[model samples]
Target chain A: MQTVAHAVIAAAGLGSRLGLGRPKCLVEVAGKPILEYQFDLLAQVPDVRLVVGYMEHEVIDTAFQLRRDITIVRNPAFRTTTTQQSYWLGGLHIEEPCLYLDGDIIFERRTFQTFLSCAEANAPLIGITEAKTEQAVFVAAEPDPRTGFLAVTGFSRTDRSLWEWANIACLPAGLLKENGGDVFTRLSRHLPLRAQPVECFEVDTEADLELAKAYVTRLHGAGTQVAAA
Target chain B: MKPNTAFCFDLDGTVTRREVLPIIAAELGLAEEIGFLTQMTIKGQIPFEMSFRLRCRLLAEIDVATVAKIVEQVPVDPAIAAFLGEHREQCFLVTGNLDVWIARLAARLGCRVFSSTAVVRSDGRLGPLTSVLRKSTPIRELRGQYDRVVVIGEGQNDMPMFEEADIGVAYGGVHAPAREVIENSEYVVAKGETLCRLLLTL
Candidate 1:
């Protein structure tokens, strides 16, 4: 399995849905800031680059103290743009099969273990969840009855789907050359959804943040279990 | 004017002995809050300028007399100080430290200083202006203003300015950066005097 050297965490949006005065990434979900947990996870994997905006100093300072190995980049346009712009602004720092983690996510350790297992398998992986209660993004996955390769396909149109996008993706890092936008932007145009059952989760609202905190705590207490897809 | 080259020099580590705010915060008993913010800024959890301004505002609550007394304990890099004195017009002290220190530093070095300033009330309570002046924008603006622009510093805050400068020197005498800034800089000089003595050729 080829190793990934640079994991890029995009943290440049005012998560208005969270209703916090600070950026969603800066909001403390448990004892740790949501972004800090993500950084801790990335520190376990490989070296990383973080793209930050909004209250950037708080983000940068917190991250640096956590892991000095990270490469900090800025996206000052966070106020008026989307995560796609933030990720694209940090494209130059991408190298290897970069794991792109949304800064506002909280999940089980098994979720990451499963993703890592799938990631090392050389197939481009996007962390997806089985627990879909809200308006979550997901991919349709069913055995192709004939050729036997999993058929993963779904976009914004397929609201009622089997699996939801956990807001985390793993790309070859060079895919940006093929399409100039983010993973979703390029995948929406180029590839169909390929599903892997990893319980990755996204935290959008304050309720979601609380849920994530509890879920992650439970997952940690139970220990990791990597599901074979 | 021969297309004045704007030389942006970071105050702490680059121009001074140590990180000024962190030191002052330690002195004023706000080290815990300030330290947390400092860690966040370096970690990419927060912006450098904002954290810096926040620290300044926190420190400004103390009297100017006390601050000046505390600042007296602050040490300037003699080599860089002399270098700026010799090339006064071209060099600019670009720091996130407050205006009081900026003015004091500029006067001491005989160069212009561009930094954030806090509003001190008659009752001596300090309040931050909160307008973010990014260190990166100033470097770009200076680059446009001058035939050449150079930046010197150590730490993640200096990454953008270092990336844009015609001559980027990371003075890592106090705290050496992990690897990113070390690799990005054109020159890495740890000794303050060694870097100053070498700057004559450039």
Candidate 2:
């Protein structure tokens, strides 16, 4: 198993659905920008890339202040594309296994680290969490008889399952297409991928924002005494 | 294997951490005055050749040695300097700046450099500009020697360099690149480390 060092964060979306008038990564939860949290966890990652589009300056300014060494790839067509496109554009031509995640969500620190650990050993892995968001593409996964870890069987919006696509994965380069249904749709081609569980709060609506705030507040209040990611 | 690629860098803001001229102006308390014109030149508000002559005249009030001293002291982008040090043979510094002003700085990287030349009067004062460097001249000159040429710059003056290269990268390490330069480039990179990484893997 190869070690993982590269990571791409799709922070280009307009966040029109969230009605924040800003990119989701800038959304402040518990008085801190979500990007700050993402950077704090990604401090160990050597090569981190961001695809910026909507209010790119704001994102770039905030990103540079966090880490001066990060690589920024622009998504000029961000208005028309999805996060999948941002993922492809951000990770352009860098041929290696890269950890991919959306900027609209918050993950438990310990669990996210565990997922990265699993990703290093598993290579191509899917991250799933218990269904908790308002709108989600549910994931159907089953235990791989050999490894005993759940493997992502399929993703469907209509299907109900205990698992939901966390929109996080460690994948080989060139697997993503510039125009794809979504991250899961592209990952679906390589089925039965190993699935690792993580605790995440994905912000899509006003309600989800409240949930994320409370989640972070709880984490801060409890410290490491709480459940692991 | 990647093709033989020549990396061309604009000296002022792209390679240095700050615009070179302003630092020289600061010595004579003309930083703000020269800084304004530098910004205008970068945005294409002033024709590069005309502005170069005018700035040269304004900065000529200072002795030639002082000008060189100021430019040499300007901080460089550490990551980019390291990249140039490692690939000096393939790396080239292309600048619209005068050669005399940047010679010491260029020697530090140990790379081939192209710049506008100027004369020095017998009294040790700077003379008039001998010629102004056209941004794309080096790209054309290096085309036969290398399989590909990649240009990096941050101002409107770099538009031609962007057009001539196989790939152009708009750099924004010091400040946001000119909008047109960003549009002309195949990629827009914000951090020096990112720019160096892209150079390594591109």
Give the best candidate by lDDT.
2
Candidate 2 Cα errors over 4 Å, as ranges = A224-229, B1-3, B28-36, B39-46, B60-66, B119-125, B140-147, B163-172, B175-191
Question: Model 1 segments beyond 4 Å from truth?
Answer: A120-123, A131-133, A144-149, A177-183, A220-229, B1-202
lDDT of 2 by residue, B171-192 (tens): 9899988877876776667778
Question: Please, what are the lDDT tens digits per residue for candidate 1 over residues B58-92?
Answer: 77668755665566567887878888998887888
- The per-candidate count of clashes, in order, stands at 29, 1
Question: How close to the true structure is residue B58 of candidate 2, measured as C-alpha lDDT?
Answer: 89
- DockQ of candidate 2 against the true complex: 0.53
What lDDT does candidate 2 reach at residue A189? 87
What docking class should model 2 receive?
medium
lDDT of candidates 1 onward, in order = 0.66, 0.85
Q: Compute the interface RMSD for candidate 2.
A: 2.4
DockQ of each: 0.04, 0.53
